[model samples]
Target: MIRFGPAGNGNSFYEAGHKSSLEIPEYLADVGLNAYEYQCGRGVNVKGEFCRQLAAKAREYKIFLSLHAPYFINLGTSDPKVMESSLRHIAKSLAAAKDMEATRIVVHPGSVGKNSRSEALARAERLLAQTAAELMPSFPGISLCLETMGKINQLGTLDEVIGLCKLDKCFMPTIDFGHLHARDLGAIKGRDEFEEVLDRIASSLGAEVVQNLHVHFSAIEFARGGEIRHRTFAEREYGPDFEPLAAIIARDRLTPVIISESAGAQTEDALAMKELVQRYQTGEGGRDV
Candidate 1:
């Protein structure tokens, strides 16, 4: 199914009188959303039994669960010690995802740092290969998704991420449309632009990925450095609006799980997206612009 949910609880969630992560799935279902990305951006600090409990609840509500790997992982590092540590972080994140029965873990494809992009990516490729080789057989249900980087100096160009995906059949690309827009100075604004991205992805990966991708969407503020921050949907000037992307997905009949990463009100924004797409699919009109 085409799932939609938030990266984490936002201000509105607490404002709505919700207090626990355990309650997230039921709340999301009540609100008509069906996806959730557990934020382990800081660390996979939750206990295994706790993750299993969450997974069970998620299954009960039919909410698709995913995880964000810790932000500190840097397989691009040349320093042997740092590379080792980064691999450990990925391994731990994978283990945590397995415990939660989450299907995928989104990871930043490392950074440029002091090295050239090519050098960093080459090193990252080697390490990621090692990671998959060691981890995949044991955790066949889990996938490591390489995210498209927003910053000019970062290691996640669409091509770079696609290339990294080639390291293993298990790899998936976390195509963050907001990041793509920010990086290109708001390049995607309509169906054609969004279609070009889909076309490229389908060409590179295959029709299956085109139809069943994992995506992240939000409006964003940026500078020459790219991706300054995520913005709520209410922010008028900042965007790669959900409307065109929604239209394209509806027309293509894809089943991508879309996660919202708005600065605040992520659940609200995600619900808005889900509703808009639903309308488009059902041939209802006058909701999107």
Candidate 2:
């Protein structure tokens, strides 16, 4: 629903003991943010009655919920045990998300170790397909989104992720604009390029998918291939260009949940993006003015 949000708990401004994931939805609600992505990066630490309470609270506040699976996952691993473990984690994360009434779960496609890129991608696809089949019955409403990875060593690419989404309707692509920019070493030059990426996604998965996009954005540093680390929006020199992205979202009437991943300044950046989107929607800038 064109939701703008931060990656983790929005209460980073609060003291450590004063904040918890359960308190985030209400805080975000108070701050005018309608969406939140629960970060289970280390593990899905929130469980049982706590999860159910959080779900109820999120519903009470009308906060749109999503989850990021643990960073330790590697579905493309050559070892079957590793793959199985990844699957189990995904299944558990999905259950947690279900309890929290989360709509989607974002996952990394895993690294390309000794295998060739294509081979790794195929392996990831098979593993994800199998995982989806197993989870479909239980988490019927949750969509599993494979995110585009920034580094060259990782299996995810825009095309590769789109291909996986095409394989199954339940699967979708979470386009990380910072990662795309880093992956290409700042190739997304302007509005047209941004539009083209969205066009490609629409072409691959149909226009309806654009209506509920799961997106991540920030300024990033990259070396040879792409993505070294995230930077604050103000700190970025070379970029994935937010203005053009804002323009595209305006022109296309796209409704995406944009999660800001700016290092240590996520809430501030998210608010800035929301303001930009609102301005774009209302035609406040020179071209429209």
Candidate 3:
């Protein structure tokens, strides 16, 4: 089923807090959010017995779990040692995810650094393919989701991520609406464009992928290339129409997990999005441009 929730802790209920990531699930449960993403942006904080305990608690509450690996990883590094280190980091996260019973692990596709985009993408593909080949047999239950990055210099794009997913069934793309909006400089103006994106994903990876979609939504600011920084949903003025997105989600009956990344207002924004989706589904709201 579709799971709508905030990006981080639902319990702590604030954006910037020093609470341990393990406590997030219980807080999410109390807040009526059915999913939580463990952020390992710095590193994997939960491990050993604690990881298992968190997983069990999540299962008890019927809260789905996912993970975001360390941001320092660069899968497209030109140096062999750097590439190997990146692979090791991903493997570490995967092990933690398996222990925690997380359904997916979101990864940032590496940067172009000094190389050309094509060169970076090619290197990234090789590293990812090798990593997948090595771990697929052991981590059969976990899916590696390559996120569509907001920055132009990053290796991720809708086409780039989808192309990489073609190499392995265990890999998929995490469609971040905010990232897409930033990438196009606020181009997602209407329902048709939003629907077209969904259609493109289905055509590329088949419709089943839509059922278990892992998504992130927020208001974003962009410049010449794409993505300057993230802003609260209310702060954005140009556009990334959530109303049209809600309508599409209801019409297609897609079971997506939408994680709100709206600065520190994630919980409040998530609730608003959930309410909007419900209204659209029940035919209580009219479509707004």
Q: How many steric clashes between backbone atoms does each model show?
A: 0, 0, 1
* Location of the lowest summed lDDT over 10 successive residues in candidate 1: 280-289
Model with the higher TM-score, candidate 1 or 2: 1
Give lDDT for model 3.
0.82
Per-residue alpha-carbon lDDT of model 1 for 1-289, expressed as tens digits? 7999999887887888999898999999999889999999897799998899999999999999999999989878898998887887788888888988998999998889999878998999999889888877788978899998788788887888888987788899999999998888778878778888888889988889879899999999988988899998999788988888887778888999999999878999999999889888988845453
Q: Which model is ahead, 1 or 2, in terms of lDDT?
A: 1
- Model 1 TM-score (2 dp): 0.97
Q: What is the clash count of model 1?
A: 0
* Best candidate (score: lDDT): 1
Candidate 2, residue 39: the lDDT equals 87
TM-score of each: 0.97, 0.95, 0.94
Point out where model 1 deviates above 4 Å: 286-289
lDDT of each: 0.88, 0.84, 0.82
Question: Model 3 Cα displacement at 44 (Å)?
Answer: 1.8
- RMSD (CA, Å), each prediction: 1.5, 1.7, 2.1
Best by TM-score: 1
